[model samples]
Target: YFFRDPERRPPDLPGAVVAPADGKIIDLSLVEAGPVHDSAARKVSIFMSPFNVHVNRIPVEGVVKALRYSPGKFAAAFQSKASLDNERQYVDFAGPYGRVGCVQIAGWLARRIVCHLRVGQAVHPGERYGMIRFGSRLDLYLPPECDIRVKLNDRVRAGETIVGVLHETK
Candidate 1:
């Protein structure tokens, strides 16, 4: 149940950003320009309950530019601080329109983060790349130009929900 089936389908809309994990959207905010990416970006935090699927999916089709692992505290995933203090894996993908970043965060009940993609690897939207063993959070950092589709408390399905859309900039 922590992996994807061959028949599973993601949305077909162009430039759509899909949810990386199944859960309720706990937070949505604009992060100040930081080390994760050069420009300020929007963050979508999804809290995966014990009953939700633990598998993680790719938010867009792109080349994996980097995969970073950070060891930190096991705070509750739903808290805003958990995005910075919790043990996590950061995956950066260079999509056609812009860059997309996904962070797999370990919650209080989660002990491990499993990411299967490597730097330079090409991945498709909604493709299973890794998973957190149990309850956890998945944070998606989107480009500043993208329009967010989900709001706080919205329920989302991994690989099936359109969480945002990347608008083309000239």
Candidate 2:
């Protein structure tokens, strides 16, 4: 099947950022935010196994400001350095309170990354927007003001688990 139905709906929490893909939370760290985000941000990387769902969902309600695809080497998604060298797609969303970024990284076992949304498109929290065939990795980038809720080695379900929460800026 190309997509699997979600067993549960996304939670209705204020400023909640949901997981984009169902997988194990492989890494969590503070990384230098790319051009799509500010100076520094919290990075949550998820490693999707073949048994996990491949479909991806929107992390928050927002407009897609930018979508970029970077082609690179196919490396193991669990490796920290793989984020920089792996083939990936970067999606930036402008939420009501803040901006967030999601990167779909191609792992050594994943051959394709499919994204359905485009620039300037409106999306909602937990909305299914894309998927990666087979196994892959998804990285959620949160602004400095947001708080991450998931930890390394945590198992997260796409669209159902709250990965982080955005805090309003003064």
Candidate 3:
């Protein structure tokens, strides 16, 4: 169903950002942003209801640096600690302009996370990297310096929403 969207294609675009997964954005916070790729990083939590599309896409163009897979309990992903304790994958991407991160989490009822890209793999913007079977969540770790254009409780369409700007890295 998600493949039918023509805007989901990958290409170089100025100030063009896409959703990392198909779901509803439930929570947003201004946390301690990371360096470089995550300079002005704002943390966004996306809750994928069972009825929503399960496919996940890359928000920007970049190469995979490292994949951190941690095993944990299948708690609900809406909680704050769920991001720290849930079974998820930490994907780091390096791009020409900057770097970014994506966190795929398993919800209480969902238990599978399929990551299609490997370390050193070059993925384009809006490319399908993997999926979370059943209900799930995706966290976008953005640069702290980037301008957050969305708000909490806002419904964002994956592959079509511009969550934030990709600031030019020094």
Q: Which ranges of candidate 2 are over 4 A from the true structure? A: 1-3
lDDT by residue (1-170, candidate 2, tens digit) is: 54565655999998999999999998888877753676898888999998888999999988999999999999888888778999999999997768888999998899799999989999988888989999789988888778789888999999999999887655
True-vs-predicted CA distance for residue 35, candidate 3, Å: 10
Give the per-residue lDDT of model 3 (tens digit) for 1-170: 53233446544566555778767788777677632243456788888888777788888777898888989988887777778788998898888657788989998988899899899998877778888888689998776666777888777777767788776677
Candidate 3 regions exceeding 4 Å error are 1-12, 33-40
TM-score of 2: 0.94
The C-alpha lDDT values of all candidates are 0.88, 0.88, 0.77
lDDT of 1 by residue, 1-170 (tens): 54333434899999999999999999898988533578798888999988788889999978999889999999999998999999999998887768889999999998789999989998998899988988699999998778899999999998999999996545
- Candidate 1 at 15: error in angstroms? 0.0
Superposed on all Cα atoms, the candidates' RMSDs to the truth, in angstroms, are 1.8, 1.5, 2.9
Question: Which runs of model 1 end up more than 4 angstroms from their true locations?
Answer: 1-7
